[model samples]
Target: MELLNLPGNIIETVVRMLVNQRKTEEIKIRRLNFVQCLEDVLNLRATCVRLLEIVNNTRLKFPCVVNFSWKDPELNFDLHCFINFMANDTNWRFETVRFRKTLFHVEETNSGLLSIMQKNASLFAKSVARLNFDLPLGSNSIVLNVLNLLDWLRRESLKAGGQISFCIKDPFFSNWEAVLLVDHLSIRGSLRRQFDIFIHLVGSQKFPNLSQLDLPDIIFPVAKLCLFRNLHALSICNLELPENEHIPLHSTQITALLLSYAELESDEVECFSNVLCQCFPRLVYLSFKNTYRTTFSDDDNLCLPETCTTVETYSHMLFYFKKCQSIRYFNLQDYYPALDRKIFVKQLLTTLGTRTALMSVRFCGKELTRTDFMSAVENIVEECHSLDVLSVDCCLLDTQDSLNDQTEIDLSKIVRGEKILPIDGQESEAMLKLKDLCRDKQLKLLIMGKTVLYKSTADVRLMGEINKLEDLYKWNLKRGCVQWLSLEN
Candidate 1:
């Protein structure tokens, strides 16, 4: 056989093809490290060109996740440019580009971004599966950019026969930023027309495929409640209902719900109860932080019957507790007034009674004395048999001083089936009654104080008694505040 001599260009082309074929196969077999490979490719101009061509030709698909690293600016820029190029290339049929980074930097803008996206709208509309946008913590025209990007995507999703998933990152706010986020995203009033157009383009049909959503600190009711029929996990903050306004009770396919700064007024509570009872039959995890400003009023027509009277308000939350039978973890925070706290604890136990599925419970409050705190623990041990992790914090009183004096008062008698006589002061009477109830029930108790001043010898003594009768844990109130307890076992 005669050896055939090949041209230099042809030999070079064949070698390049062999190398890319090996890399592509490695990617397919999961043998190539994506980060290392991308880094190496980015470092070489030749490799970068080859990788870009390979990416364009093969159109690889990847999962989208939120990224928030200031160190990977070059990678972010590269990815953004690549996405824009693919979106603008009418000849390319790339579908399903995973967007990383939930927080978008407003300072990073290219005029070519929109025009390219608009030019390739048809192709993008046909292929994109998940779109993740990051809204960084800056006051720039990021919202407008998001609106423009969304508009283009919406138009494309309409022409295409596939669903799209959208996610946004929200930062904490003290003033109107939260409100602005809501107003910008919510499809209400005359803006409803524009929203309806958007809904038709991307909402009604595409939203059913949404599986995970995260809105860490923004509250937009209209946007939140609209397209979550198939949502599995959601994180939100500052969820509140307006006075005299009624939120319709609707169920979504949500399994985990995390809410912060939730303001559930009397009426909204009822509406929520009705919806939760009937709609979220499969919900398993629910967490909420009730804002400090929430209050109960007798004239509030939407207030549940249990909340109609001052006595009832104490246990009113119980009325809605039974509805969430599938819940495994429950967290409540910043709930106030000693009476409300006591009622809430009692009702929670009664509502969750003997439910073996519960794994954790956390409650934070202010102004709770040692007596009231111990009673709450006993109630939980007696009533909620499934609790594995329990936390309770008193916000107003000193824990150390209170615990020390409290221990000297004889708690083992109370915990070991012995009743204590009531004292004359109103506060003392409440404390004595709680102790008596715990003694009668023979329950384990855990107490925590929120200030170092609260972590005195008295607290240590009280904690000792609690350990004697059952199990007891005490946290120094002053050192770390609320986060220390959260971090502990």
Candidate 2:
């Protein structure tokens, strides 16, 4: 009521401030708080007649697309308020809508809820609608509701010239016709016995516009890869290749490939690499990681050799990139074979140097002394001429006191934890030296360790790469070169 007594300009400013508090540009609203949002707006409008006039005239934008979850089906009926509000406000533009999670346990009495949701879906037919289902295969009425909703959303999305994307598990694979409509599809669980049928469908032109794929566990043959002619990016966690004399050539549209825990026989390494190179000729980004043991028990340690306990060097793993000359970004992690640090580094540098176009490289699972690690950095800088970014995931052990002061210390000869001393100022200075070297060569270095993490200061762009996009992939690190580093000019 105090606002009514204020000057006209002041009252108008207050109203504008309150409305602008919720910005109209690209707002995201979760499902649970939909009612509260409307209540808050209506409360403000009900405060006074002048406020009601201003609120009615001013466009209060809601989320373009409405999202509903099965967690609270009853609340879905309340969604009509928001939709009705959007309907009245012709100035509000509806964009895309996405519905996710399993749909279960809708009583027969609440069957009108599906109709209400379907009517809403029909309004947004010219926009994208993504539906992700993780449901059990059963004759439940709820599943029928979900399928019916998906049918409307998918049909509307297509009519709008937008594609529907799905993240479905094994059970939903039965709906092959619906699956074919997906532009971006991620198969969560194993395909199991249906893998062959899935492969056959893929080769038979089932997924015509499929662009992005994430296959968690499967025995996807190298020959069938060509079936995904429109794929742009692919993530495969576990893959087993069948013995095939002939390999199919894949379309060169795929640009990103991520592989984790894909075990390969030593003989099959080169063949696989050759097939991969032959298949995806345009692939510029690659990530390969194995399940290297992070922690070990004393009982298990007794059975393993000291060399085996350290980082295992799959020197032959270099064959993968050797086959692909177009790769610009490569990430290798946790593949182990018992080999000395120096030998592995030498093999890595030699193999990587041949990939003249490679711009960024990240590797984990190898342990190195500080001296050896610095030496490897120097070698990579000198040999890999085209490389602009390098990231090392392993912690380096300093053999001696790495302090800057050149004073005599008896602790140098003291043995602690296999004669490897904890990193000190010396390692930081060494990193600074490498940083300077990389800076001179126009390179960026990202070394993962407590010392580096705390000592090194990252620039705005580098920090964004480390913080924002790290979680997007299974591997946590920047994929390509950083434009800038926080280095003293």
Report lDDT per candidate.
Answer: 0.40, 0.49
Error of 2 at 171 (Å): 2.0
Name the runs in model 1 displaced over 4 angstroms. 1-133, 137-201, 204-209, 214-229, 234-252, 257-274, 277-281, 288-316, 322-328, 337-341, 344-351, 356-372, 391-489
Candidate 2 structure quality by residue, lDDT tens digits, 1-489: 676787766655664444333322113222324333345456777887777666655544333323334325474545565577655643332344455444444652145535655556534645443444444443445445555656765665434456556666544554465466677787766576667777777878888988888786754566667677788878787445546646444545776666655565555555665555566666544555553433222222111111111111233344433433444444443233243334335555665565542232222222434565456567776667665445553422232322122222211121111234345326556656765666655454443321122124345665544433242333334322213335443
Q: Candidate 1 versus the native: TM-score?
A: 0.37
Q: Distance from true position, residue 247, model 1, in Å? A: 14
Task: Give the per-residue lDDT of model 1 (tens digit) for 351-411.
Answer: 5655422222233333434455555655765676654334344333235323212212233
Tell me each candidate's TM-score.
Answer: 0.37, 0.54
Top-TM-score structure, candidate number: 2
